[model samples]
Target: MARTNDDVAAMLEEYADLLAITGGPDFKIRVYQKAARSIGAHVTDIAGYDTTELRQIPNVGESIARKVAGYLRSGTVPQLEELRGRIPAGVRALTRIPALGPKRAMALHQRLGVDSPESLEAAIHAGALHGLPGFGEKTEENLLHGIALLRDAGERVHLGVAMPLAEDIVTALRAVEGCHRCGYAGSLRRMKDTIGDIDIVATSNRPKVLMSAFVALSQVTEVILHGDTKTSVRTGQGLQVDLRVVPPDAWGAAMQYFTGAKAHNIRTREIAVHRKLKLSEYGLFDAVTDELIVSKTEEEVYQRLGLPWIPPTLREDIGEIEAALAGELPDLVTEEDVRGDLHTHTELTDGHASLEEMVAAAAERGYAYYGVTDHGPKLYMQQMTLDKALAQRERVRELDGTSGLRLLHGVELNIDPDGDVDWPPDVLAGFDVCVASVHSHFDLPQDRTTRRLVRAAEHPCVNIIGHPSARLIGRRPPIDADWDEVFQACARSGTALEINAFPDRLDLAAELIRRARRYGVKFAVDSDSHAVGHLANLRYGIGTAQRGWLTADDVINTWPLDRLTAFLRKKQAAGVSRP
Candidate 1:
């Protein structure tokens, strides 16, 4: 098999570490690290290249190329294996976990005999890890908490969570006089699901006035950190909100800098640096003239830097700049593109809106159709019964005749750990559509989690996979699984991925959306609304699609009623029988 980029990176990383462990010179160690980085950043398929081509690169030498060739041929780099034997794999895995550095890992291993994450967790639970030499109880507690937090979250939260909090803050801030154009910056602006901290940028002539207004907001119960230009507050929800005031002229530059993934901005700045121009919060400045070039808008700054306007979500330090230069920055999806919502709930289940009320709300939003997918038999918390669910579907059908909206009688079926949904074949076939979801067994191992999800996706009646990872914004991490494998199964099974638009459950983040898109897996941008007010969450779901570089064509719900029905029919025709 050909060597994957991850394979090459792992080998290079191991080699770099071996060089260091062997007391090699810092420059020598850096050479291997550089080679690894160059391999990762290379946009072209390095796996497609021969060993000779790999060696021709500036960083990769003959020895490294030989190792690459061996890895490609045998699926193992002997050098990496040797290094793994010399150093401990447990120590390396510990480094990958956030907050636990190499020194800390070493200390934990030596003092507490906690070499692996499992062992560390055991130590933590037993209260055996309170304080060690050179480490205090506070540090241990922080480490424990960090481990749990990291374990709880994937890389980012779904856009659904980030957008609402952002809007709420903006609304509160906009109430302040002189608070001109208060908007969210950072990943939240980019529509990232899991935001680190809410970055609110306000352009104001009277910034102090706005700042005073911000600190006095009802949502902000206590100010954690405050300053003249910036203020940090702990909200009612366990989230930190940061507000920054910038001059009107510098709004664009400041927004660009502040609403960044940092790495993305650094790459953008590199382009500026190469052009003998400086880009910063102040604005873009010409190096030779030492004069301000662009100051009013982010668009002007990008144009001045000889680049296309890049979206905040695509600002991963990846090859987006080159893509932008090549005019290939994806044409992202918009709110107008979303034709309808799929995985919504009604008062028949745990929802606060009645069937008529929900359909009327969807019609008011000009949707051609809406899927009233209330909770199914497994989620008894919603107090749903088979007879009541059937009655509810009949009621939806009843309203559809007069409502002019094509209503889909759908059920959000809970996929048990054994991969069985609560519905039999007769019941499953009764509904127009079914969304299979995992509501429990969150802490399953990687293989089991992957299997459980794949099994659910493969269900004959499962038209869509609802929140495949079962992540709850900041509170719960996604189930451990090979998402590529899971999405590939979804593609094979003709199951669509639902971007649940509930503020707390944007399960599939933008990156996953991008991956699923690549796998030819379709998406359903669902409101997953529990009440009338939650119908507005469609915007958050649409924002997520945009951030994922999704177009209208990429989403299943964007299709008209007939097209959607045809797609469902096709999926049913091709799918296998449920076990």
Candidate 2:
């Protein structure tokens, strides 16, 4: 079995958690956690290297390298297995609940024997939690709420969580001796906002070796099935991944069959039937003689059907087939089309990096411009006072010339309950760009929420509405709002809505973006990055935008620097003021 970088990382993370619960040395636990972070963030496969090479990776010391080597050589680490034996798996799962750290989880396990979510819920309802230290009525209530949220978020994982795991597994599969090609398919490949499970397809001569290696991955906590052609496993993160190996002759057909929404595949099969051909996971065959036709590439399959190859993102049976037949498929926005990131943060508020560092990171990515839109004074723990804002602006101005990147000094002003910004007009006018956002009152009535957004959009100083829907995937639903009304106001007022690139908040979802496009609403795909590493989230935003059928022209950040600057200036010049 070939281990991926994520496998090593997950093992280390689990080791750290179990060690912590078992009262292991704090320094040792920290070392494992740090090593896990380094491995998880490494661009390439750390598991492919020997112990000496592994030690060269940042935060991976001699001890961690030896453990990693041991895990790769054998299926399990002795220390991790020992710790797992001491702590029940259910207790470890408790730590994943909100507000339940390892220490608290241990307390629950030792004091009340509450190990799982169900047991914890039972304890809370039975009033068994009240007498425990640090567990009051309020704490119990919060725990119950968290449990409900967890239950509601069952089975599905966010794109951010699932994507890396899938990529790691795919990388591992590709490393096999006889593997020709391997890639993820299904919803993850489609770049859906949330994914249920991951599906991977590969072409390989040695199906038994490929399947065996896949099921033996370090991340595989449980193997559901193992066969010559197919293997399925559940990872440590509770994501089920299935890998299928096919002959080179059936590569395209296998990919098309597995990378499907059931409806889309049904439609395609229906088309095949109409053409007097048979399409299956094996290959396309002639109806009369059953002769195998082309099956090496997706384009070949589509060509055989007399249709242009549709992008995987648009294969949702959402009029994409008709559009392809008519030669009208949208030239969707790609990551390369983006010129800048309009919504970003800095140390002045909640961001991890300084303004100069953030700007340098953006410039490194070949961005023409980067906005410094740290939070304004309204957001708790992330408040930027007027003095701090002014000082930050001055700093930005000083670095603007020497930084070799165009820096737009800006602020992310909070939209209050009344749909009004916290800052006065003069304060708002001082910045080159202002992103208005709602950080509170997510439960407002739909009409009130719509009015609030409309009011924010109508403000002349506002250039973009940040994370307009404010949905945290798998955690919280989008705030109730009449999106059509809000879109109308934004289109009329020239305020671009943001496709927030944050993995957890791919706001202004694809479906909504598609509908808003009808009203001529412009969009900005922003990273809303708090740290330099988070800037990579821009790809997820671009994927979401593409899923919405957005074009380069539809996203303002894709415009040239001069054009974008001119648009912002025009919006500022409109002279509309807050009521």
All models, RMSD in angstroms: 7.1, 19.7
Cα RMSD for predicted model 2: 19.7
Question: 148-235 in candidate 1: lDDT tens per residue?
Answer: 6556543444455556777888998888887777888887777766666788988888888988888888888768557877888756
Per-residue lDDT of 1-579 in model 2, one digit per residue for the tens?
222776888999999999898788998887787688667645445545889998977678888898999998886999889888878899998987867788988999999998799999998888888779988887887788768757855468878999999999999989998999999999998889889789999998889989888988899987756888888877887777989999977889998988867657877888999999999888888988999897888889989998888888888776677788999999999999998899999888889998878888998898878889999888867756899889998898988856467889988989988898878887888999999998989999887898899999999889999999888987788898877789899999889999998988999888788878888999999999999999999999998998889999999999998888887877768777665
* Count of clashing pairs, candidate 2: 0
Cα lDDT of all candidates, in order?
A: 0.78, 0.86
- Model 2, position 395, has a per-residue lDDT of 92
Off by over 4 Å in 2: 1-154, 401-403
Q: What TM-score does candidate 2 reach?
A: 0.73
At residue 518, candidate 1 shows an lDDT of 82
